[model samples]
Target: MNNKPLAERIRPEKLEDVFGQEHILGRGRILNRILKSGRITNMIFYGPPGVGKTTVANIIANMTNKRFYKLNATNASVKDVKNIIDELDTLFSVDGVLLYLDEIQNFNKKQQQSLLEFIETGKITLIASTTENPYHYIYKAILSRSTIFEFKLLNKSNIIDGLKRAIKIVESELKDKNIKIDEEALEYIANVSNGDLRKALNALEIAIFSTNLDERGIIHIDLNTAYDCTQKKILNFDKFGDNYYDILSAFQKSIRGSDPDAAIHYLARLIKAGDLISICRRLLVTASEDIGLAYPNAISIVKACVDTALQVGLPEARIPLAEATLLLSTAPKSNSVIKAIDAALYDIETKDIGDIPAYLKDAHYFGASKLGRGIGYKYPHDYDNNYIKQQYLPDNIKDVKYYIPGKNKLEEKIKSYINRLKGSEL
Candidate 1:
């Protein structure tokens, strides 16, 4: 049996063999243009894991036909970087060197700074790969010297293509073993891997290796076998890192955007990361801030879901959480309540505001009536239709309107009712 992993065994050697990231690697793309020029410069590949950052870096070095040296920033010391630079200098060739650094974000300020002179002098062409936002993690000095190419997660189609290629390679190696994989099994692996081609390939390898051939001397991988092999989908979420906030942002935005599918997807990610508190808190906020008066009952539903989730944690909690996510995502969207409150608070903080009107003050307090606190206060209940228009705001801001109803059906009804009441008072 070959000890090498399937992903490593079938790693793409040429740009054409690369399955995903067509946006950058496709014909007439920026990477293609750079490769054709045969003149490489310092560049950073920024993206999620298993998205071919290291693969692309290797391809660049191979295509350029330069002296290739690789270093993992995690364990490589500043001395190691200097040693590579010194070695490249001895080559004394015009080709220059291609230094592929993996996890460049791990390099500290001192280590990163050490590479400046070498890169600046054009003696070392840096091809760095990082699973982080380079702007936030990498030093500005290094970023300024290198062009950044963002690699996005492979889409479903791209992942499926990669899985097919892996399957073919495995079958070829097995030869007379007569291994066969159902199309649905391939799709299941693709879907569960969530756009990580390396993960999909690994899952395929596991399913094929773990399953025993039937009496017919043929190994048939079915959907159930695939699910059993790749039961736990690897979630790219860090509970204490930027991904935490990123997933939360995506969840709330999906609900606000009225996309239940996206909201549930993000919710699943949070659940998989065991972040129940964030899910409940964000859902509650979305209910009030996004749904608001558009669906006054949404807050209650979300609160119930949160309470239920807190009471019964984990697997069961997912049910209520899913309910709340779907409810808030489909509910009529509105931010009128938040907008009104923010507008009122802005005026109170920035502008000189008057006190409460005398008629609206507490008349039951001692000596309050003597000070004319309750004077001229018209009781609406005593008027015709039990309605009256009285000044609620202070004398200075009586004309100000803050609580404008939203465009949803419920808010529109409230708006009509308010208009009718005001007209009757007139």
Candidate 2:
């Protein structure tokens, strides 16, 4: 039996053997065009784990005829990098070097900067792979020198295709024994992998290796055996990673888009990831920012739900979270509140204004009639409807209109009432 792990045992040797990421590696794609031109530039491969970042880097080295050297940034240091740099002057360096740095995000600024000169001068073709966003974690100099390709999560179909390849490799290894994997079992592994090919392959290996052969002299792997190998479905969420932010973004957008299904779907994902705090905070923001004014009561309802969720944490907390998500998603949507506040803030930040109107200025001081304070101020209660058209803004920007009521029923009613008051009393 080969001691190497199944992922390594069946690592794709060629671009055609690689699974997923067709966007980059497919025909006529940018990376594909680069490889076909017989020249590999300095590049950054970024995405989640168990995709084809490292595998494609290896394929590039093999196709380009460049000397391939890999170092994981987690443990590699400046000395290790110097070792590779020293080779650039040797006879073996005639072919050039392709340095594959895995998890390049872990490398500090100085360590990444050490390779700037070599990569800039074409002494080494660097293929830096990171699961984190390269633009955020990688040094700016290194990013400026490389093209970034994002490797997205593999879908279930792509994962199943990879699993089929693994099954063939496993069956070929056991020539004396036949391996029969049920179709349902194959898909079970694919579904539980959460778009990670290597994770699915490992689970499949576990099911095959750990199961006992039936009386038919064949290793029969069923759904039950697959379940045993995969105890829980993979949840691809890092509380501090890009996935967390992406999910939160999608959740809020879904609610704003009035798609309860998508909103609840992302809500469930957040809940499964144990991100109750993010969910609560985002829900409250959505109520005010997205559902404000249209459903003026939504803020109160969502606040109550959030309080309930906090009091009763998950798995029970998902109930009130779901309620809040669905309520905000299905409620009448309006961004008037956020827009109004933001417009006011923009003026405060960028524009100049004159003094406050005397009628609106503080009149409660010791001064009786000094400083033109509270002069000609008509108390609203003294008016017929307890409302009078008055300028509350500074003199310069008093005519600037910031709050444009949304075209919702509540805002429309408020707009009509204000217009009536302006016509009757202005």
Candidate 3:
């Protein structure tokens, strides 16, 4: 009967107890600087759910020797925020105050402006957390006054570690009870959790109840038991916030893995559930990034899918998406473009390959001729345009060809064009 929501019961007390985000909180990081001094400048933590934004906020308050005034932007009135700020004003002489705003994006323009003066003047050390993107929700004026830290969803490995930690906590809590979780069950819980530790632990707790048959001190969680518990399963779109990315990732992996069936399945799910137009737009990105010159039409088809979406509207538009997914998935795969561009970019980042080749430079404008922009530019229109060899690419990549066409039947023509261009001598 002593139920305090297990996640809350085991909420970490100190920074060390927190599971991840070592990048920001670890030694010599900004957080360490803030913690050692107990002086928090205005900061906004942007990320998905259960990624330790709120927990870190609390730890900073505790570590800084500052007064903590918690406010939920969702429920807090303008007066509530003002009162919290006013209280901090009174405490200015005593000690610094950390005003922790949960779901800070819910605060409207006026509400945000009210806190701007305090934040800018260092009258208040504001630590705000938001699941929604602050760039879209938080007012620009207030956002400029604060430092933003992005939090990530717990990765699969991190989730596994967290689950192991949670299991110890769960077992310790039920010291007198006969309850247990097996590896298969843990794996199932971890996979189904989609990177939310709290959800995984809760699901594990439910699974244990549903499967009460213990065998020789080991509580086995059978697939059937898990199935029964999650029979009416639903995607945790709210908690994970991977609606578009989830579908995008699935499609990409499937296309790369060459599983048209899975690609179609995800396509179906996305079309049936959310905005097909957004899905089409992402497919266009993947078609270019992943499919590339292997199937140049992949990008065109994806664009067509988007155009189809915009023109046809939903309900009827899922057809083009399905077609696009099928085409791109079954189409020949190629990341040659990805590989080539990345290599070129790596050189750019690492090397100081000089300016544009003179012939390849612009020649049309007045100052361009004076600047030696197009000293020896080639005019393909004057030639057969077929054999005119020009230095169009960067000198570093002049000989490096990135678009190795795939063996798709239609790509045959593209391959011929590539061959002609590569071997030309105009």
lDDT of each: 0.87, 0.90, 0.72
Q: How would you encode candidate 3's per-residue C-alpha lDDT over 177-225 as one tens digit per residue?
A: 4555556656766676666667766766666655655556544666666
By lDDT, the best candidate is 2
lDDT of 1 by residue, 107-163 (tens): 999999989888898888888988878888888988999999989889889888887
Give candidate 1 regions above 4 Å deviation. 92-94, 167-178, 207-228, 241-243, 342-402, 413-426
**Could you tell me the TM-score of candidate 2?**
0.97
Candidates in order, TM-scores: namely 0.78, 0.97, 0.64
Total clashes in model 3, counting residue pairs 3 or more apart in sequence or in different chains? 4
Q: State the lDDT at 102 in candidate 1.
A: 96
lDDT of 2 by residue, 1-426 (tens): 888999998999888888988898899898889888987899999999999898898888778766789999999999999999999988888888899999999999999999999998898999999988887899999999999999999999999999888888988898888889999999999998988998998998998899888899899999999889986886878887877899999999999999999999999999888888899999999999999999989989999999999998888999999999999999998999999999999998898987888888888888845888899888999988898767889989988888888989998898988889778312
- With candidate 1 superimposed using the best TM-score fit, by how many Å does residue 160's alpha carbon deviate from the native? 4.0
